[model samples]
Target: MRIQLTFVLLFVAAVLQAQDIKISTKDNDLKLAALPYYSYGKGLGITSADSLFQLNIRFRMQNRIGFIKNEGEDDAYDGQIRRLRLRFDGYVGNPHFLYVLQLSFAPGDVGEIHDGENINIIRDAAVIYRPNRNWSFTFGQTKLPGNRQRVNSSGALQLTDRSINNAKFNIDRDFGLQAYYLNEKKDQFSYNLKAAVTTGEGRNWTKSPDNGVALTGKIELFPLGSFTKDGSNFEGDLAREKTPKLLFSGAYHQNNNARRTQGQLGDDLYQQKTLRSFFADAMFKYNGWAAMATYMSRASHNPVAVDPLDPTLTNYAYVGHGMDYQLSYTFPTNYEIIGRFSTQKANKDIKAFTPDTNEYTLGVTKYLWEHAFKLQAEFTYDRLSFNDGSTKNNWYVRFQIEIGI
Candidate 1:
């Protein structure tokens, strides 16, 4: 409770600081308006008088606490600042060219050290060029078009975090180049195609690479029509679309000569291997109801790498399959109820090393002002079945507070 109060007080201090920080010789500050009177999610939108360039600045923080009770083991607790980030997004030269820069401040957001260092503060630094309404090209470090759950921004999630499938098989972020095309016809039909080529190494790997590369492609189709306000990106039907909206998406990724355990992520591998990943997901929303289902799988010629001379030294990729499904309903009063079932199974390659698991979660959220300010709580029943026929059960309770602008 003390930590939570401190977080809120710190946010208030930040708001005051933002209102006083000048950005130009004219003494203009980043504040769009004085605190207690501000827009929802617009952040500090700054535009040049000539309209030649623009900038939008936003910051967000996620504070979390969780308690866990393991079967036949000691009860434990986990709490921390899950995510704290600041982002700057806008256009330069003209509206056709755009750029975004994001930075992470929380310890957990930086991820575990890889390639020997822990200073992974920068999250995204990308420049995009949109030639027209239908086409866009992106360059520099950013997220890959691998999975729907991974592509969605973390601040707009329905649950405490993404599914287990994403943890193992997601082709996260990298230094990459991407091309995208979108075609839509009002509330009728729409489709989007995205493709990217990135260095096999994940983000913040400053060391030299082995000339490896990862290729990712994804396509989404809206059969019944598109969601209002690009609602597909958000987890639930916050906008409460009057009409029905549905989206089906598929993605494929291949990492050649990957040097990490989880293909662009994880600790370095003793021997590099080729990994391929596949994903399929569906999202539906209508009249305050929302549902999502996803499938993920990965295959490798030889997922396990063994040192011939040193049998004790072995490393392998987490090659397996998993599925996740979620359902939610929101009331007119801005309160929501959510339920999810997630499961994952290991393949023959690393089945003995990792366990097969199932998880059931129930959650509730209160949105004071959309997702800009919300309180969330959840409970999860976790069961793990090992390859050796042993099973372990646990229970987890969590609560979170999110504040953003």
Candidate 2:
């Protein structure tokens, strides 16, 4: 009953805004300008307005099936829920505060018996006080302005998983307060700086009485085309000027953790210590090609050391590196072929924190029926190096079909 009432209220509010809404009825009444509501799960919805001071909602359902084969083990097949999301995003009032309440259902055995019922908040639900074009202050769940790749959604990532270095450098999404300023220059260059105070931990947990602070910054070189002047969008008046036909970006980050701990080889629990990390990333893009690389390292003040006499003490600093490359060529009709490669390595110290595995993948994609349907195939290989001096190899092939309207 409560859910139904909420839907009713939403519908009424949408109707009330219809009088002021300007829809492109003559353009194509049957054609939708955009899908206001989206979900990865099993359903979708729409909004009457899409601009600022508007209302939007989205929902989605998804499923995934995976298989693995090794030398001694038979084929391993498992199917599970990928995502089940319901979200409401919009703005309200004179201050123009934005808010979103998202509920997600995913299969996990974290605190539950099997894949039990799990619902929680996800993503930035904040109000942006963008008083001007080059500055903004946001308060709520948001990503710390770190690397462009880290700020982008996981769905848009080129790799199947985030780099271990990225994970170590920045806490994914955090509940915090932040302020940022960004400006694009008429000479085809841009820069941004942001600082935030967060719980240090991820979004899953609540605020600790004593939280940590993280600072991040990014600089971009858009040599291909000018993006904006000092305070306004750059015009194409200088198209005749010769410019580098490529784009480049780089970022840096640092986080201070006052209360951090890790486990040992024969650990009964993770010990607490002072932790700190630093990261750097760079990206380059030409007409039809792109490449990215990143490195991160974390050190502790009181490094944990194993007891030589007991052979139970364990201690080691953590470090990692990741690199990725992609090349694609799109025709006038939007048909294209893409190739990608990525690699990540971690320092081998302890069994769990050590670098003992790596993965490689190759994929091809084709679009048909005006891009409403897509077909793709991917092949992946994983190599594992055990601490006990053993090696294992596994591979898999995947085929997928996707349709969108």
Candidate 3:
């Protein structure tokens, strides 16, 4: 009881200090306001807090209605609330530290009801310290700074999801620390680069040993130019000007665990795995049409099933690869027609997971009711091939209607 009371007092003391600092800034500083903000889609956010020390909240809800044909049955269903996210983002005054806490409720509930109620932590909490505009350091439970395609959030991506290699490398999310740097006005070109050190296990923060750290980095190119006749703007423009952008990213992850010994085998074996990946993506927009293509490959050590004859001997080898593309055309009425193709190929020896898949999709999306609501539909064809000569094909049609206020 005494320890709990002491900890509460410490927290109160910290809050008092923070309040004092915020009061000093308000006396002779710019007052920042928060609340009652509007959002149109996702990009280029403009929002602020009531004061230097304040809390910000953002919420989103999504639904997926589709029909899928599994091995035996055709399941036609409308899945609602596919994603429900509530996020909190803000900063402290004196420390000047930015923080984000994102909670995904639907996925958590789905995992519990679907996967035997396995205990897991699906939410992410991160704290970033920006010493300057050019450099920032982040430490927390979050996604690693890997390839551009993987780093890009689903809310901003142009496709349904990431490619096969990305899913295979499973760099989805991990607990780690990152250092990011950007040179926005370097001559005629600008670039964004980030480096991260993390546990190789994807989203397995508890199982990670302290021996190894995964290293990843990305580099993107930006074109510079002007559109307006007046020479008033010095920073340049993005929406008015038209240009192409390219991104290249790569990562290397390795881990060495302590050796294990068996009494009957009279031998020792160490579990060590190494992975390397390379990715390239390009996006171009001309007139009312846009094009995007991405390619990535991964090489990693995967162990074969254990041998009953000799428990001491094990089999391990390396391989995987994948690619995807998107072509979209928008009409004057803001309606879009999109076609996408993706393919994957992987090593023959690995069977626990294979990357040999092909998919083709055609989609159309239009805005209605003063462009405040979106109606979209798509048809997809997927083909899967296994190393054991087992093949499967599937067709699905999806329809979605989203509205914002």
Candidate 4:
């Protein structure tokens, strides 16, 4: 309780201090100002007059309510705080050097812990160095250079939530060093590349628990010029591109002798295995219409080994393939309608334990103030098939409101 209280107090103090900071001009060269904003949340941003240094304090929250109906089971309804985040981003001496620090302060954010209260608050703590326009380097903890949806901010998602495929196969976040490069022509990006090396374990692990690491690389090509206003990173055609835009991306990732049960997010595995994943995706946008598709596969070099003493016990990594197709159109009134189809299948070898599933989702989003303040609702139908040839079906409806500053 004390630890949790401390975190809350610190967050409150930071916000208060930022608001109290006075703006001043000393000889017109050393000027400091606090810019309070209420677009996403109520917060204050500090910046130097010359724009060489900046500090933005932002807070965001998501509240969700949902109901689920499982095959042959009673319907369940629930409500919870989906996310509560405090973000601090800025540059110290020069704009070329940037840093981001984000924290999550929700009970659901911290799962059950054995030692004490689950106070693992840090989400992203990274420093980026941009030497030039074409290249940059990042160090510390952040999202791995993996699938496109996995890299997209959860707060910016078009649907009520990400697809089930993403929850199962996404690499999530890790501690790593990332290198990025881009080639552009006439203010339009032609190609871009990102590479990273990281501890296979997920966030909050102070050290690598295994001998090996995870390596990932992704490359993107823009054939019809870059998506207007970085549409490739976001959902919907909010930018309403006047000209057609297309993007093709591919990524390869490998975890050498991974220890985590879920490769990087779950409990430690009893035995390590080499895991490999491949991804390909494409995006196209014209006017207010946008479409995207992604295909991903993950496999283990060796199957799980049965316990020597217990025949029924085994440890292994998930081996499966998944694909997602999404389409969306935004109207002039800032209302968007989206539809998605996603499916995943376990490898034949693991079919006995893992079930194949398909999901269909349709949603509507009203962007009151872009993604910063939006209301979204979705209905998803899920079908699961077991190895025994039997099938189960389930469905859910969810409504979420996103608030950020």
Candidate 5:
């Protein structure tokens, strides 16, 4: 109810402001326009004259239906609005200065309540400054520079969802400042670098009582030139490159004296401890085929802590390593076939419960208009081995549709 009220107030304010402001020019420099679209998502955008001081508003939602069966349990059917998003982005005065504000209205987006409020809204509120073509800076709340799969927008994914490895090891989002630099040599190769410093806490945290910070750095090398139309950020061979294109990337991130249960997300930890993570990935695309492989690991300086209430009670942090490999082929009709394999294991020394897991998935996607309008279905098989030498298996089949404007 609060989220709905806030959205209404914001919309009203925008409407009032638009009514009061009017641009006058002799050469017709002032212009007003609205673009309505429907593909993967549906929404409208309003733009100003000269392409400066523009406001774009868009809404996106994903509907999913699936069934999961555990080793001995009956199959369960489920349906959900996986994601419901509202986004506003534009620039003020100059194109070099840009901003983005996004909100999530889905029930699943609202996590545990904090400070008497459940913040399902406000996913991103960031400003970017690009002084030149080679360097740029960003400030505010956004996704941290981490694994390749995590950085890709959820709406643009080729499959129904990301792999389990990404959920376990990816550094999601935070409030921070980032610096980026890119150097390109025409069709030869390209080098990209990024660095960030941020509050270790996850999104929408009003305060960081832990006083800890996370540092991250990433570098990428494009040996056969960069992907077409930010293709590196999107999955599959949408561009159908005539020649081979490859990207090699690596990243390192550390949260100094973190207080969160899962480094950045989850409940607050009882004790502060340092968390370190590393990632390496490679991507290749040729003709209508694409493939990628990634390795990720996380370690905690102090994985276990003694409970204050009970002398024998203890808690442990999540420490583990994982790998993911995926391949996809897109036919001329815009139909795609996808396959993926992932495996992960927790640190053996920890006394707490940690399960080793392996997953295999196969999926098919048909794009009516690239990623903007697509229908996808996938099947996944999972195997788990617990510390007590017990094993379990599960499988799921899901179907999803995405439409965007």
Candidate 6:
């Protein structure tokens, strides 16, 4: 296994040690609470009397119904739970140390079935160690610092779902070590740097294939200082900033000897190939308006892989480029209208397997309680162009509702 049996044990002092004990443990000072406290969107929270240990419980569900129409095919419709997740975050011992655990309960949220099997429901199991105000380190499984769209939480998006560009090139999540540093100053130049080393396999990686691993680096700079209300992580200009705010970012990632068609994901490749990706994106918000753009490109020295033992067996690494742009405006009534355009091109080497595509989507959302509880509806026009100069088109219509504590 990639972890090589490297195990970390966290002995949390639960709030059940009120039996003649001053504290559960030296590092912890939590006790049973008579009642849990509630917040608008923060869910249920509790803090120890001594304020050493704390916890928050939150969960959300996305119920959706959709219909699709193809140019020359019969119409199809389906309804199901899109996402169901439970999240817990709190400080354990040291205030600088934090723990986060998230689990996926929706069938689709778990993972795509590979060989009739899915991964563990666990989505995030990580700990953050912030030694100082400017630095933090993370260990365990979590989302990677890839494109801003990929790094952003799904619950924070204005769109019914992420753009097609993210589905194609996002590195997603893995088990690894990540380091982050930030130098921020309001009304001044602010920047952040991120780096990670991960086993180039999914969290369920069984064997550590030779030297297979993924390396990533990212940097973001805010020329005019940070956006109010942590605008960078959520879509749209909910904060309605009076002054303009801008952010620019770039990232690079490399997966050596990857065993999947899409590096860290997709059908298990019987062969391996080193894959590289380049990314650049920017965000801007001003006067109740917001816009964001992203670009990604992927390449491999040997896009095609062939088994040494079986000459006829082969696999091809997904290689191509994708780009998307999003714009939205929030009204004083807590309503928002959003539009997006995205395109993807598969390298000629693998064009037959994938296609060059274009997409346009328009959506409207009503914030019942910010992102925690909302109603959304969208329509999409999709076009697929093949290497043979042939094209196909489809249309999608959907509605969704999200609610949580």
TM-score on alpha carbons, each prediction: 0.88, 0.66, 0.71, 0.86, 0.86, 0.88
lDDT of 2 by residue, 1-405 (tens): 353355346435544544443433122110001111212222243334533344455544434455668757999875665545555654454223445555566652122322332233454455554333444456676565555455543433333334434544444565555555545455554555555555554454442434344444545555444321111111011112333333345555444443333211011123334445444555443332334555545555544555555767665534345554444444444344555555555544445555455666665555453222445456677677766678788887655544433
Better candidate number, 3 or 6, judged by lDDT: 6
Minimal lDDT window, size 10, model 5: 29-38
**Which candidate's lDDT is highest?**
1
Which of 5 and 6 is ahead in TM-score?
Answer: 6
Candidate 6 structure quality by residue, lDDT tens digits, 127-237: 876554555567788877788887877788898889887887888888887766667667788998877788878665665556777888889999999877667778888
Best-to-worst ranking by lDDT: 1, 6, 5, 4, 3, 2
lDDT of each: 0.80, 0.45, 0.51, 0.76, 0.77, 0.78
Clash number for every model? 0, 14, 2, 4, 7, 0
Kindly list the per-residue Cα lDDT of model 5 for residues 1-405, writing each as its tens digit.
353355346435544544534433221110001010112332465667676676767777889999999997988998998888888766688655667788898777765556754575888888876554555567898888788888777877889999988877888888877666667554788988877788888787775366677888889899988777557778899889888999899999988887775677765666677889999999999889999999999898667766666858666667889999999999999999999999988887562477899999999999898887789999999999888888999999999998766
- Candidate 4, 243-357: lDDT as tens digits: 8888888999888888765677765566777889888888888889989899988888665756667878886677889999999999999999999999999888788987899
Q: Estimate the TM-score for candidate 5.
A: 0.86
Q: Lowest lDDT 10-mer window, candidate 3? A: 28-37
RMSD of each: 11.3, 10.8, 10.2, 9.6, 9.0, 7.1
The CA lDDT at 366 in model 6 is: 97
CA-RMSD of model 3:
10.2
| lDDT tens digits, residue span 1-405, model 3 | 353355346434544544433323222110001110123333222334545564556665555678877554666665565556666666666335667676677662234433332234455577765544445556676666545555544433333344544555435555666656645552265665665665544442453355655566656554552112110111111122244332333454332231211100112234444556666766555455666677766565453334457777574433566777877766767577778888877666565455378988888767452122556678888888877788888877877665432
Query: In angstroms, how far off is 337's CA in candidate 4?
Result: 1.1
RMSD of 5: 9.0
Global Cα lDDT for candidate 3: 0.51
What tens-digit string does per-residue lDDT give for candidate 1 at 1-405? Answer: 353355346435544544533333222121111011122466888889997788989998999999989999899989999999898877776665678788998988886655467578988888876554555667788788777778877878878888777888898888877766667555888888877778878887777668677888889999877777667777889999899899899999889899898998887777889999999999999999999999999998888998777989998988989999999999999899999999999888798898998999999999987777889999999899998999999899999998899
* Runs in model 6 lying further than 4 Å from the true structure: 1-40, 112-118, 207-209, 307-310
Cα lDDT of candidate 6 equals: 0.78
